[model samples]
Target: MDKERLYDELRIFKDRHFLQQKLKSPLTVYVLLALSYLLITILFAVALSRVSVLSSQLNEMRKELKRNHSSEDFKLFPCGPEAREWEYFSGKCYYFSLRMTSWQRAKVLCEEKHSHLAIVNSHAKQNFIMYRTRDKRFWIGLSDQNAEGVWKWIDGSDSTTGFTYWKEGEPNDSNQNEDCAHVWTYGEWNDVHCTYECYYICEKPAPL
Candidate 1:
């Protein structure tokens, strides 16, 4: 009887289980969205921080480059061995002839040296050449050899467009054959007969 009572006490009368609660609607989505948003925010902050660092480094490099090259001549002419026997200005090399010759002969001489007559394109170049001229007349490479009154450089650049330093009542093509351009004593320009003997200027490309 005691054994039967012990068995009855140890036996379970009904099946038993702990209940599990289901997550509520919308709460699951809210939690997932919060996690996703946090992950994306962290990634964006990392990318932005890296970009800022790179930008700062590039700016510093640019400043250093400018500082290093600051003393260098901004003129593209390298003024080195390859540009020997020439003077540099802006980005071109100029050669002033000590001898006087006809405009056509001057052009021939310049072409022989693999260059053309000086083509002044800027006020600075005009001033520089004038200072070197010392009040003497010099021939440039401008002409209307192709068409009357339609002036052009020997290199075929249109001269009607920019920075002309013509003298008063000049380039009148005085004899209807005045086609070549020359600089006067005070840096003014005039068109004269190609046969006129005058000092010439030559120009060529600067080095690489």
Candidate 2:
């Protein structure tokens, strides 16, 4: 009876040791898996941060490139003798001298000088020219003489849609006989008789 009792106690000890060993192995495996997951998560976060920084830099570079291209695209005209004393800006040249001439005569003169009538594209530009002229009236390159009341610019642009600075009650064909457009003392546009004389503005494409 004593031998049997000792044998049963030994078996019980062996079973308990086996269970402890099995539990230790599975616990170690779980710890290793958790550590691997933490490492992967850290690496993914770092990669995403780097990608975000690079994207922001790329966008800034694109905007800079666009600004440079815009500046490079415009070419200044009448660069040499014609506007020798005048300052050039944004591909256009200005002459501040108040030289008055008839519309047809002005057209002929500008053509001889390798230019055409000036076409104002913006209010700022128009104001700049108007201010420079010392409030004197000048002739722009728009006329309706051939068509009688249908005005067109020297560059073939339609004046009807582009007229932004018309003088009050202007282009009224005041005498019911005005067929030419001219700038006024107040930096506005008005219709005048074709035979009337006025100072003129001229334009030409910039040299390549």
Candidate 3:
């Protein structure tokens, strides 16, 4: 009877151990599934946050574009004798020359016409210049000739203190000689030698 009782106790312990092992596997699987769900939820939340921020930025950009396009300052006005040969915008007259010349000569020519080489200070003006100078390289009124890396507009204004739109990796002063600034047809600035010949744009204030 003692041997039979000992065998019954052994069977009970084996059944309990098997039950514990089965419970442990299911618990481990539940823990793993819970962690995976948590990770997926966090990732989805982050993605949603990024999408929201991007949507807001896109809306702001659209508003800005609309404002720029609808402003009367962006309109072209060619009125009176002073503006006959020039395109007027935002109280300024611009002359896009067809002849190519050295930067120095171009500056002198503009001055002779009672104007100066173009000094771009705003995006709207830059766009207008680009539209008028389509597919042509033109010299603007910017240079670092007086001091390397210290660009200044022809009006003696500091170029670093205001708006500037330089092409990527430009104004590199290639061969240690490039000092004059010119605009590409695509509306970005680059530095080249002042002696290099190119067409130019002139800017002057419109008469009140």
Judging by lDDT against the true structure, name the best candidate.
3
Model 3, span 102-148: residue lDDT tens: 99999999999899999999999888887888857899999998999
lDDT of each: 0.84, 0.74, 0.87
Task: Find the 10 residues in a row with the least total lDDT in model 1.
Answer: 14-23
Identify the superior model by lDDT, candidate 2 or candidate 3: 3
Per-residue CA lDDT of candidate 1, range 1-208, in tens? Answer: 9999877765633212211122344677688789999999999999999999999999999998985564353343355444556778877888899899999999999999888999998999999999988778899999998999999998899998988998999779878899998998698899999999999999987654
Instruction: Give the count of colliding residue pairs in each prediction.
Output: 0, 1, 0
Predictions ranked by TM-score, top down?
3, 1, 2
Ranking by lDDT: 3, 1, 2
- Tell me the TM-score of each prediction against the true structure: 0.60, 0.57, 0.61
* Tens digits of lDDT, candidate 2, 1-208: 9999999999999999987887689777798788889999999999999999999999999999976654554333245543565446556665533577788888887787677777876887787777766567788888787677678887777777874677887777869778777778767888887668888877665543
Runs of candidate 1 exceeding 4 Å displacement: 1-84
Clashing pairs in 3: none
Candidate 3: segments with Cα more than 4 A from true spot: 1-79
